[model samples]
Target chain A: MVLFPGSNCEHDVVAAIEGLGGTAELVWHGDRSLHGVDVVVLPGGFAHGDYLRPGAIARFSPVMAAVTDHAAAGGVVIGICNGFQVLAEAGLLPGALQKNRGLKFLCRTVELRVETARSALTTEVPVGTILHVPINHFEGNYTCSPETLAELRADERVVFRYVDNPNGSIDDIAGICSTGRNVVGLMPHPERACDELTGSADGRPLLRSLLTAGLATRPA
Target chain B: MKFPVLVEVKLREGIADPQGATIERALPALGFAGVEGVRVGKAIRFMVEAPDETAARALVTKLCERFLTNPVIEDADITVG
Candidate 1:
């Protein structure tokens, strides 16, 4: 887990990963290395107090240097919620997360549909499968240039889309992977939905899917 | 020399701006009429230390593209004084 100073979801993500029989370690934003980790996750929260913008400040964090290198090496990187914003700001992903169309901080459970099963983040989940997850953010509406949107469509990089379009995101995109399909960024908080009592257990397959991908990338 | 920079960031022309629309709708209810094409944007002020005005302008422009605004969906107007 990559822990930005203001990130509040690191523990939640760590707990979820542990619950799924996966070991997780929190790496501070100032850290200069990934410690040879298999996968890197940028969890949710108001990083750098969301100053200037949600992820603008956090993108410049030292740990991001290692994260960038990891992604370049085809290592798995999943950026959730605020983490997604950081990835977009860092140019690791296309487009930007603009303020919600309603201009309010929305916190609620939402339904996401798997749009493509080509990414490691969603490969276990069959296409068109709907997963219940929670999203909490004031800026989760994703926007990209027309050219980039076309490229995403052509490459089939959109991994997930909202079932009901909660945040006015273009094409109802909830998650997307990079061209190489190793890096994924999404708005919904799958970690928040790992439990049956609190949220939903639908997030299990998604998290497990990452473990499978990590195992593949593990130095053998 | 050090120059004060003002960066104004606005959403792209075609993007849906609900906040701006909401404010526009409120204007007529407040007895203000004929206010059309209302849009909302953000202004950021900072100091830039550069060698000359041309360099300062170039720096601000780069900042606008790199950090101050999302070039994909927004445009930034930068002024150095």
Candidate 2:
């Protein structure tokens, strides 16, 4: 996982992965290498004080060059919440996240319907599977041009859609994958939902899917 | 030459401005009238060093396009002096 200065969810993601019997590590934002990790995760938090905009300053962090290289090499990259904003700002993903429709910071569990099972993030789950995930953000409303939206829909790159449209995201989109299908950005934090003791373990399948995908591409 | 640059960033038309709308909603309660189309944005000010005004404007415009604003949802209007 990549750890920006203000990133608070790195530990949560590491704990979640470890609980599922997977190993994880943290790479500082200033570090320029991913250390050959097959899967790169940009955890959620207010990086760089969310200066200028959420994820804006973080996109220029030295480690992002390495992240971009990893993505371009077909490695799996996942960005959750503020990480999603970073990916968008870095041009790793399409569209941008603006302020939520109600101008309120939402922190709650939301139902996310898996729209497709072909991408790395959802390959282990069946389509239409509803995963209860927690989202915490003040600017999670996803926006994209009409052309890009049509392209995303036609290409079946939209991996998840909100069942209730909590933040007024266009097309009720909660997650999407890149054309290569190896990169994903989503507003919800699956790491926060990995334990039944916390609330739900629906996030396990998603993380498991990611780990499985990573194993497939691991250098043996 | 040092030029003072002002960049006004606004959400593109047709995009929802909830912050502006929320502020507008409270206006009627305050007995203010004749208010509509409330939208919110930000102003960014900086200084750029260039040989000429044209060069300064171009430099600032590049900054606006690449860093100062997100063109997907916001447009940046630049004023250089």
Candidate 3:
């Protein structure tokens, strides 16, 4: 996990991974190396106080060069919420997240239907599976060019779709992956929903899938 | 020489501007009718050390394209003095 100064969900993701019996560690944003971690996760938060834009400043962090290299090498990269914004800003993802259509910071559980089971985050989950996940963001409306949208759909890169449009994202897309299917970005925070005590554990399948993928790729 | 640069960033045409729309919707109630296309944007002001106005403008444009604005969904109007 890459930890920016303002990252707030590093511990949540750490706890969720540990709860599932997986080891997770934080790599500071100033560090230029990932230390050979199998999976790179950019956890959610208002990094750099969301200055200029949600993820604009954070994208230039030194650790991102390593993160970008990891993704290019076919390693798994999962970006949740603010992490998703950073991914988009860094050009790892194709779209940009703008202000919500309602212009309100939404904090609630939303139903997300798995659109494809081919990506690192959804490999174990069946397509069409509905997961109740929580999304908390002020600027989560995803927008992209028509050409890019067409390409994403054609490549089966869209991993999740909102069961009901919540933030007016184009085509109700809740999450998408790179053409390689190795890098994934989503506005909803699966880490926050991994425990039953937190209202729903529907996120376990997704996180577990990530862990499984990471373990499979771990160097011997 | 140092120049003052201003960059106004606005959402690209066809992209939804919720903050702008909300403010536009509330304008009529305030007796300010006939207001249309009340798009909201931000202006960034900074000083850049450059040789001339053209260089300053070029530098600011580069910043806008790479950092000041997200070309995916925004346009930046830059002014240098």
Best by DockQ: 3
DockQ of each: 0.75, 0.93, 0.94
- Give interface RMSD, per candidate: 1.3, 0.6, 0.4
Report per-candidate TM-score of chain A alone. Answer: 0.98, 0.98, 0.98
What local lDDT score does residue A114 receive in model 1, on the 0 to 100 scale? 93
As for candidate 3, its clashing pairs are none
Per-model TM-score on C-alpha atoms: 0.96, 0.98, 0.98
Question: Which whole-number lDDT from 0 to 100 does residue A201 have in model 1?
Answer: 89
**B9-73 per-residue lDDT for model 3 (tens digits):** 99999888899899999999999999999899998899999999999998888889999899999
Candidate 2: CAPRI quality band:
high
The stretch of ten residues in a row with the least summed lDDT in candidate 1 chain A is A115-124
**Stronger candidate by DockQ (2 vs 3):** 3
**Least well predicted 10-residue stretch by lDDT in candidate 2 chain A:** A211-220
RMSD versus native structure for model 3? 1.0
lDDT accuracy of residue A204 in candidate 3: 91
